[model samples]
Target: MSQTSFQTPTNKIVLSISQLNQQSRNLLEGALSRIWVEGEISNFVRPSSGHMYLTLKDDQSQIRAAMFRGQNQGLSFTPKNGQLVQVRGKVSLYAPRGDYQLIIDHMEEAGEGALRREFEQLKQRLSEQGLFDPAHKKDLPDIPKHIGVITSPTGAAVRDILSVLKRRFPAAKVTLIPVAVQGDKAKTEIVHALDRADNFNQGQELPIELIILGRGGGSLEDLWAFNEEIVAQAIYRCKIPIVSAVGHEIDFTIADFVADLRAPTPSAAAELVSPDQQELQQRIQDFEQFFVSTIQTQLVQQQQKLTWLQKRLKHPGQRLRDHQQRLDELDSRLHNAIQNALQLKKTQLRASHTNLLRVTPTHRITQLKNQQNNLKHRLLLALQNSNQHAQQHISQLAQRMHAISPLATLARGYAIVSDPDKNIIRTSEQLQVGQLIETQLHQGHVVSEVKRIKKK
Candidate 1:
């Protein structure tokens, strides 16, 4: 091989910036195809296009990461700034800016993940100990005379519970036991309140049958107090039925597992404890109507029997002259009274039957059929009348046509004389001497020629 043919100019080996960056990207991507990085998320930006851009940083350094819309859409939770997260992605360099970025495919909370694992472990342990057993769970009262609410008095949870209780059943007496629902003191306050409520309920003559221990929606940190073991133990030891409503529907706590019943929200807990007044009133009204109807029906039946007996009493047979004669009168009176009563009942039943039929579909259908037939007959009669008028109009038009027809004139003893072109000559002025012409009469046409012209 020639030296110059195989070798390039060696003075300087220059490369395009794009080519350099492209090779670098391929190298970086290939070297670290898939890896997991744990860091605190910062400067998270989500634009209208749905792509999430953020910086994953630790104590020393940070790197840009992008989670495209396709991968991030299935996430159960949203990522925020300063959140500890573990992300799986591929490393790549941007050719345009010569910058490196990880193309993240998945993400989850780092610190929260550990907490959730612990939560699951504790749940399993408690479940094995029969803490969540249904046999141990007491039934909620149908109508709790008094309810004790253990939560922060100033929190939205208390307001929601109070409003729902008042709306559903105003008769229920509510006692609010103020407690902290979050922070380091939240667990202790809740445990103490549960104990105090239990003591109060036992000491008082009119005891509360139900206890609602709960709070509102929040992050895992904000709701960690409910997951404390001491709070769960307190709920387990309480004699009164407890309703656990710690957060929104998605959030659950250890207290929820140990309590007699778990409601999704404080309002829902209130609803569970209180019977709806409107529904109760409707039920009462229905029962009353049913009772009254039953009583009236029985009374009517009894009245019919009593009337028959009264008739027999009013027409008692005369004192017996002979034993056989008295027996005959008694039998006759009994038969007649029974027959009258039966006849009256049959008449009333027939009236009821007729009234029932009047409201039935068959009766309405028959009535509608009669009305439809009537309308159909009227339409046919109108059509016949219209046809008759049309026929009369046609006869009048025929008479008018005949009156204007030239044949009518010929029929009246007059002939229509025309020149060879068939133009009628109405007057002698239209006639010319020696002009061939034809005369149309009533019966036939005659050929003729004008022999003379006369004016008169």
Candidate 2:
């Protein structure tokens, strides 16, 4: 080797602290791009920013690990200290501390048994509180007037629900209550939205009568907000009925247990409350067809009845013949009655004429002549008999009169005594002593005073 003096000129370049730190980070990240690590977690901390910081350790070594909020957001289970976990991420250096750490993108419980135990514990707690009781469930509205939705405003779930509602029942009103569908604030926002929908009629004329609380399909952690106790209680307490649609057709949550109904998806929930408009229109058309056919049938029956009645109506010739026959019968009966009456009148007149002739004036005159002759003969005999009878009767009557005469009694020496003023004599018993009396004899009367009493 020959000693030759060759001097090389140095060009110095200086970097800022950030540029130096970035270079170091790139170098360490490239060195451990893909790695699988198993260890127990320690000194675990979750900051308000949603990033996790922890130490991973084995019996002989320990290293730091971190889970950024974005990557860990979809984890089904939470990470805790002293828990064994398996992490899949890249190894990187923190330039500020120059310390090596694992940047975890995925993590799971180290054993399947541990994950199952955690799931059972959560399920047991919820079940013991009667969250899954059918008695606490409500019934779905048969006809929904307004449908309220609680979901992410920009999510596919909202689009699916709107599409189904529009096709099935376009007249129904939809109220969207936009909320976070995942993350820590999801449960709180969902509960508040449910309350608002339930009380929407407070200041309005109409309100949502049925609510759909749902989210699109995701893992258990992404859909955990609906499984929260607060969300389940809100569903139970809602005055308006609720339909729970979380995750997929096979996934269920606490909200599903307490809601009025459970649908397989957001679209299915819409269909539950609404009917197809086209189907209803088809039914109405069928009814109209049936009604028209019935009317035609009745009209046909009425026309047939009218035709039969027309055939039975009487003809003019038959009506005239019937009237003529009746008139002929009446004339014949009238002629016979007139003839009988004439014979009866003639017989009665003959009997009257014979009765008058039997007692005619000529016969009566002959009888009167006979009666006059007999009367003349009887008159002479009657005069002779009357003269003889008169003499005998006069003698008998005079003799009888002489027997009852008062003069005859007087001649027999009988006298009558009476009051002188009245000349009335009844009996001697009526006379009183010293009373004036009059004596009536056959020749004259004498008046004197009673001088003695005589009882005989």
Backbone clash count, each prediction separately:
0, 0
For candidate 2, lDDT tens digit of each residue in 1-456?
Answer: 223333346655556565666778898789889888999999999989999999999999999999999999998778888889989999888877778789999998886435455556666787798767788777766667777889999999999999999988898889899999999999999999988886776777767777888999987777778877788778777888788888789987777777878999988888887878898788789999999999999999999999999988889999899889999999999999999999999999999999888699997888899999999989989999999999999999999999999899998888887785676767678788899987888888788898897777
Cα-based lDDT for every prediction: 0.90, 0.85
Candidate 1 lDDT over 165-256, as tens digits, reads 99999988999999999999999999999888888876688898999999999988789998888888888888989999989999999999
TM-score of 2: 0.42
Model 2 gets an lDDT of 0.85
Which pairs of residues collide in candidate 2?
none
RMSD of each: 20.1, 34.3
TM-score of each: 0.46, 0.42
